[model samples]
Target: MNEAKIFSYGSIPRKGDRAKAYLYFKEWVGRFFEFDGARKEDDVVRVVLLASLNNGYVEGSAKLLDLCGQTVRNHLRYQDPSSFLQVNHELVDRMKRLGALSKPLTLAIDWHDEMYYGDPEAEGVAGTRRRRGSHYAYRFATASVLLDGERLTLAATPIVNEPVIDHVKKLLTQVSELGVKVKLLLFDRGYYSVDLIRYLNSLEAAVCNTAAVSHKGVEGRRG
Candidate 1:
């Protein structure tokens, strides 16, 4: 039998604990996902879970599980991108239940630019400041909560010609719906737009700006 490995420390583990943990995640994901029976639905779930655990791409994960990477691609061919949003909500719910989010959290929102060398006219490509030898890039805004010494992602969305305020609003709305309270909002200088700053001032929480300008009484936090 294959050895079951759970990421617990030197703590004691009960018999069948590893199997139970594996089954728990499988069942949890199945609750939010569906696939055709002919899709080898269980294998689909296993592939996804393995890839996520490895924090690697599908091909790398498939090689470890002796699975053909094509299975993942075939199943995703007709999948709706937005439908997976619920899965994140479920994950947040689990963390909340475990008291990981018992208090207000400090959130850091930042822009991530991935340089795109392809034709700028291609869909989902946005014009960005010259960097990495490319003026055209794919931009993504990520919202993460400062937890312990690490950042746990709250939301991530591609910036495909959307206004910054609208994108921030959408991210905050998603967090609010999941019952998260904000202690402070941190912003990098990339979000130093007048409209965004004005919107942040309207919020009830303290603001930490990494840039020169900010609302009155809000201190600039330099990293």
Candidate 2:
């Protein structure tokens, strides 16, 4: 097993395990992704990740990274958002090959909403429930592996006025294609529909009608 290198004051550039992991991950993503009209794809991706993590605009993140925000914005604008499926496939494959995955994952499938400030008529925009300020938001379904102390998302797909089961099916297929076995599936109440519940019940994994962190057991589907 590889252990984390000790931080040394002797080095001019101090990169601990976290920094090393980030740099390595960035490099891996850069090698796989070839963004259109983007010569500096690394910078673009960095800004995008930073922006997403902080809930800040990508342009703002670019400015912080000392890059041309407009250029990064344009590159990001032209990229296909659905292309993440392939990347997740590669990541899961790599992890499995390297024996990094714990067997029989307890997965959680849930909805994610990115509140949109733009026009509601825009493509890929869906209605946001339980919100007065933002009626329209971009919705996504994400399947995540719930380990002892960590939650790792396996796959995500965009949802624009489609049945939750359809998106859930896509994630399940993606995860299954990666050859990761799932023992239990914890689902959010938003995805609590007749079709989805029936589908989960049919799966080899036991279905839990609760979140990953907290569970109510596999008694039956909850409305």
Kindly state the number of residue pairs that clash in model 2: 0
Residue-pair clashes per candidate: 0, 0
Worst 10 residues of 1 by lDDT: 214-223
Task: Report lDDT (CA) for all predictions.
Answer: 0.69, 0.67
Q: Where does model 2 exceed 4 Å of error? A: 1-18, 35-39, 52-57, 78-83, 130-132, 203-223
lDDT of 2 by residue, 1-223 (tens): 1222212323435445445545555655654455764578878878766775556887678888899998887776767655655767776776676666747777787777778878889998987654648877887777888655667788878888676678888988877777787766777655555676577666653433321232434332222
Please give, for residues 1-223, the per-residue lDDT of candidate 1 as tens digits. Answer: 1113223322535676545555656766664555655556777777777776655566677778788888877876656666678878877887797799988877777777767888999877988778879988777777788777656788887888777888788877777788887766767765666788677667654333321232233232111
Query: Which pairs clash in the backbone of model 1?
Result: none
Model 2 weakest 10-residue run by lDDT:
1-10
TM-score of each prediction: 0.69, 0.74
Best by lDDT: 1
RMSD list, candidates in order = 6.9, 5.7
**Which candidate gets the maximum TM-score versus the true structure?**
2
On the 0 to 100 scale, the lDDT of residue 34 in model 2 is 57
lDDT (C-alpha) at residue 86 in model 1: 81
Model 1 CA deviation exceeding 4 Å by range: 1-24, 114-123, 127-138, 203-223
